[model samples]
Target chain A: MSGALLADAPGVLAALAQGASAVLLGLGLLFWFAGSWPLLGRASYLTKLHYLGISDTLGSALMLLGLLLRFQREWPLLVLALLSLVVWNTIFGYVLAACSQPRRRP
Target chain B: MSRLIVIALRMLIWLLLSADPELLNVAIGLAVSLALPLPRRVRALSPGQFWRALGESVTALPQAYSQAARLLLHRRLEESVVHDEPARVGGRASSVLVFLDVFRITLTPFTIALGLEGGGRRYRVHELVFEEKER
Candidate 1:
């Protein structure tokens, strides 16, 4: 019994990791869908942009994190990608919000 | 002092990206880090402020997630303009606080800042659900 448990330990750990990765990926997809659905409604451009940008950023980050867990050897690249996503996404969202604002009259 | 820190951080990132600890890679990273122009005013958060922001974010995450989930599950979309009351914090600190608020709110799927209004003192935020009391 002890031998069997020892033999299955690695397999169990691997399966656990795989399951976690899949769950993360699924949650990411769900966020994407949730964020996108509101865009088809009567919300204004700014509202739509909000949902799309925030959800997309979170979803992408979650997906990258999932991949990072599944592929530990490529952590360097994955970490870089995740950092880029956070910084770039925020900057991009700021730019979009700024551009959408009304200009002040002289 | 901040410039040196920035350069060191860049070099570290360069090393990570290169994934090689060879002398040549290190030298290249050093050179690149030195070549990059540092910001004129590098803002460094105090440890206290950093901890506050971290704690605030930890507390806000669940609220944001539930808000998003509620919005999505109900398919309810509402638009209302809200302003952030003026904060007592001044100058760069206030700006940093505003940025932190924006970042925290946007991290959730429910709320997004449209723009800074009232000369950057107030943020015009669009929420997934509109609250009449705030309007």
Candidate 2:
């Protein structure tokens, strides 16, 4: 049974490979924390945004790409759909915010 | 029929990525099971509102698709700067939800989220570059 499961595994190994990068990212974050990176400790708002935004987006996207690659055969549509939904949600959120906001007179 | 198909496909994708098919089924069943009974508070004057909302969603599919495609074609615009004048406050929190909603907005390419505070109000915004209209 275990062997059969392994044989049917779509991107099981790829998932594991992606997991490795997750570990790398986690480690980098740890190093930054341990070194008390000035940005992490008390950086200005925009600076902090730069750090967290880059890390969060790249880390998440890399992890998703790995998973998608692994699961490509069995669930290609699902992967695309999930990615589309995430993108759409972000777009909708921006649109909603923009619509609700007022422009300044300058 | 199309609506059901869309819902089912969405459910399947969610289930697969979540890596838990049974949980997905259970959640869906639970949602359907619970949705039939309206709590007293939400028992609206007319049920037409629900159908109206559904119709709106059905009609919006084409627009959503176009928007999605347009967005995909471009590199994400991540940050924008907004210069906001001060805001005045009424009670301790009339604008609280509005403030929270604005700050919560984030984008893809270069949009910077600004948390606003002023005379009495709060806002969150991103600045975008658009050309001024002539005349």
Candidate 3:
């Protein structure tokens, strides 16, 4: 068994990586569904936004990690996407929350 | 100056997107970064302040994940309250620092920074806590 595995070590490693990436992708999708399901509920807007943050930023980041693992040669681009997506979406959520507030007289 | 840091950030992003270190590519990246107009005047930002804020933002990523898990697993949410926390670096903080602060706060599932209120002395955070706390 050891000799058989040694002959195709690279192939085995690649298969394992592919399987792991698939799991990560599925998990990220699960996060998206779980987070978004609250939007239809009676929860307040800010609470909904919190759920959105988890789905949009963290879930997407997880998906990006999956892609990064599967496509090692394209790591730089994947990394750029991951960073911008996380920062921009998180900030966007804040903007939405801030705008929802009533203005105070200066 | 904070502007220098902003330019460096742009250049870093450009390099990451292009994935090329050729001389001409570097030159073009620098030129574009300079060409882009920065928002109304950046204030002086010390290196220590910049790094500390950046470090906090990085650490927030893991914390954000944990909070996301907590939020997802809990079937009921008790309430969300808007409250103020004394600012760590208050009073006209650099925009970069402000951005990092906002990013760190809003990245987590349990909290969102509503913006600095009460004359920028504190951050007005909207938070959700399901479990009761013993006072």
Candidate 4:
């Protein structure tokens, strides 16, 4: 019985990983929608930019994590993508916010 | 110290991109890392300072998720304010430290570092605060 359980371990682990990947992907989608929903409202531009950071950076990061779990063999590429995406998008948001402000020598 | 970080970063990227663990590949990666031109006038950075900044940046990841959740759940926005936050490092922070500081600040949904002000001593951050009536 112990040997049989041991033999089934990989299958069980794979199933668990698959389930976790799905959950992460679902959460990422929910975040994306929730963040983007405010864009249609009358919120100020800076507020909208704040929401954009949530959607573009955090939501996408969740999705990438999901992908990383689902496709374990592609981890290196996924990691590189995750790092660049998070850093680049966050800085891009800052640039947008900075550019929107009135020019003041600092 | 900063030069070491640049080379280390380049080597990391090269290894990630190549995904090869062979000796030849590693040798070539090291060669490429050294051959690449580093930025001019990189400010001095101590190991302690570098590690601290790195740790803070990583910590911001979980903080970002929590902040995002809060922002989404609390739909009512009280107001947007541009606040000045003093730099985390001591006087004359290096560019890498500044970049990491900016990354940590802007990663969350509530705040974005507009730019550094007061002679690179403080970050001009635009922040959003949500209404706290539900609490």
* Candidate 1, residue B52: lDDT: 70
Superposed on all Cα atoms, the candidates' RMSDs to the truth, in angstroms, are 3.8, 12.4, 2.2, 1.6
lDDT of candidate model 4 versus the reference: 0.90
Report the C-alpha lDDT of model 3 over B1-135, residue by residue, as the tens digit: 688888998999999989999999999999999999986777768999999999999999999998888889886778789988877776878888888898999998999998887677788899997863222
TM-score of chain B of 3: 0.90
lDDT of 2 by residue, B46-66 (tens): 334334434544454444333
TM-scores vs. true structure, each candidate: 0.78, 0.33, 0.91, 0.95
TM-score-best of 1 and 4: 4
Question: DockQ for each of the predicted structures, in order?
Answer: 0.51, 0.08, 0.81, 0.85
Error of 3 at B19 (Å): 1.9
lDDT by residue for model 2 over A1-106, one digit each (tens)?
9998789686676666567756755644543342233344653344344334333433344445544544556565546654565445444445544555566442
Model 2: lDDT to the true structure? 0.43
Supply the DockQ value of model 1. Answer: 0.51
- Comparing 2 with 4 on TM-score, the higher-scoring candidate is 4
When candidate 2 is compared with the true two-chain complex, its DockQ is 0.08
In the range B21-67, model 4's lDDT, one tens digit per residue, is 89999999999999988888877899999999999999999989988
Which portions of model 4 miss their true places by more than 4 Å? Answer: B133-135
Off by over 4 Å in 1: A104-106, B1-5, B21-31, B42-45, B54-64, B85-88, B94-99, B116-122, B130-135
Report the lDDT tens digits of candidate 1 across residue range A2-100. 999899998898888889999988898988887887788877777777677647777777788899879989988899888778657855776686687
List chain B TM-scores, each candidate: 0.60, 0.31, 0.90, 0.94
* TM-scores for chain A over all candidates: 0.86, 0.42, 0.88, 0.95
Interface RMSD of each: 2.9, 9.8, 1.1, 1.0
